[model samples]
Target chain A: MKKEWPLWEVFIRSQHGLAHKHVGSLHASDAEMAINHARDVYTRRNEGVSIWVVRSADVVASSPDEKAPLFEPANSKVYRHPTFFPMPEEIKHI
Target chain B: MSNDTVQYLLRLGDNALILSHRLSEWCGKGPALEEDMALANTALDLLGQARLWLSYAGELEDAGRDEDALAYRRNDRQFCNLLLVERPNGSYADTMVRQFFFDAWHHLALQGLCRSADERIAGIAAKAIKEVEYHLRRSSDLVVRLGDGTAQSQKMMQRAVDELWTYTGEMFESDGVDEQAVVAGIGFDPVALREPWLSYVREVLSEATLRIPPADAFMQKGGKQGRHTEALSYLLGEMQYLQRAYPGAQW
Candidate 1:
């Protein structure tokens, strides 16, 4: 019996007002241990204000191979470009 | 300014120094690779903290000495770390529980140190406390997991805690040295640090389904005065051997 627990993905916010970004994955018996392991592994520098650990199975990630089709189409949309519109000339400032 | 203050800080420094040295022994011997790295990293943090504290103590005494002099030159009768820390790393469970106990107390003590009257001490404490906080969390997390983990793990952790518990009381007891530091505002009231430490430990133990060992025993003492168990001499001999034998040899 392979009694080992599933792998978990770790994300951490380095400090306040920062988004939690994926750091790495670790194997643990449960969510608590996973977070603990993540802390020891990732936050040794005190580089986190918040952490989010999820079972690796639960995270939905976009495929890198699909990036051109998924994101490239938007690049040709001229209206989406902020340069299309001039900055409003405010009475007080540009 | 006071001789006793120098003594008190040296005690704190020695505890961190020796414990860090003991933890470093687990560098390649940990139960797992990740754990080995974690222990080794924590040991480095403690050694850094010890060097800073010892250097500051030396400065306060104006003894024309520095951190290395104190660390390498100190005799066996001069170290004041608890016997528990000096104990061999018997097992993963043993090391984790021992670290848990000390980290809990360290967190509280560092909190008090943050307000030290000495600017240097306060600055060091402020910086070091953050690292100790993480260490406390790491140790606490393992303690709970192991305590609630399996029958064998629980038994081992419980035994480690029981054996180490007697030494914990001395952490909160103030001696003449502590009294002087407290009066000078350069130290904390160890007794004042007790309640929060107990509550923190109690909370973790309770959640782990472990009972607090009865507090009725005759608490162990004398660690802060360089009077140690039989284990320390052996540990010191190994730890100080290179420096002692080579006398100022450097890499």
Candidate 2:
């Protein structure tokens, strides 16, 4: 029987201002190899400057069923948006 | 174009082309999915480098031949790659050890070739060296990890390294064409690459807790002289199948 390596979620930092955005997941034997695999798989075209890899097991994810209760409240809370507070045109670039 | 130049470039192109073809055999057979991607990626890089070198060889020869004609049409005896590149990929451990040796040699060789008095050769070497560097890192890292990781892995790696040691001698072999190419400023001497390659291989093996095979091991030669083992013709049969079956066919 073939034994499988552990899964890692890959995060790639494209440029200075960008965060380490999750690109995809892959299997590797360890953290170091996971990062190496991430570099080869996710950044083959020089698409990233840095990478971060975490074992998929380490992540705590919210359940999909709770999306409406968790996020729908923000959709209706228009007062929370800064644009909802009108300002005079004198404040350009704000 | 001097025939010496054609001969020199054929060695480089054939090494890359044949190794790429070997790695392509691992397409869906890799032990893991990510490893599959890594091997395929390295194969693509070598294939691209092969195209450049073979295409330039065609240009230098000034014959009607092009890259496709040179790569697919040439028979086994006409190929002049280093012997190390053509040995069968025995196992994952053996494959990585083979890659480690070739990667070290290729990386240093390209760094020297980057200074070629010929502009096109230097330019291609400069670009290809980056890919070779990455290949070296990946292979050496695996060599160290697996060599030190477990008893089974270490045993497997040691067996592979010992088996491949004899073939390493051909990488440093030189002849009249090698001398002329270096004198013509279009090629670098492979003998000069030997010490650095040894250092790199030794250091990595040390870190991996593996010992280098004894230097007195019986050495083999002749791949660079258009002489090859029986494995090469079989490789060509698969690689050249399309061009052989469909005359002048294009994808």
Candidate number with greatest DockQ: 2
Candidate 2 per-residue lDDT over residues A1-94, each given as its tens digit:
4478889999999998989999999999899899889987899888998899999999999999999999999998888878777789889887
Highest lDDT, which number?
Answer: 2
Note the B-chain TM-score for every model: 0.97, 0.98
Candidate of highest TM-score: 2
Distance (Å) between predicted and true CA of B225, model 2?
A: 0.3
lDDT of 2 at B103: 97
The sequence of per-residue lDDT tens digits that candidate 2 reaches over residues B1-251 is 38889888988999999999999999999888788899999999999999999999999998989999999999999999988898888799999999999999999889989999989999999989989999999999999999998899999999999999999988888899889988898888988888888888999999999989876678889999988988888888989999999968997
Give candidate 1 regions above 4 Å deviation. A1-3, A11-23, A43-52, A59-94
Residue pairs with backbone overlap in model 1: none
For model 1, the local distance difference test gives 0.86
* lDDT, candidate 1, B1-251, per-residue tens: 47887887798888899989999999888776668878988999999999998998898889788898899888878887766677778888889888998999888888888899988888988999989998998899889888998899899988888888888888888888888888899889989888888888999998887878876666888888878888888888888899999998899
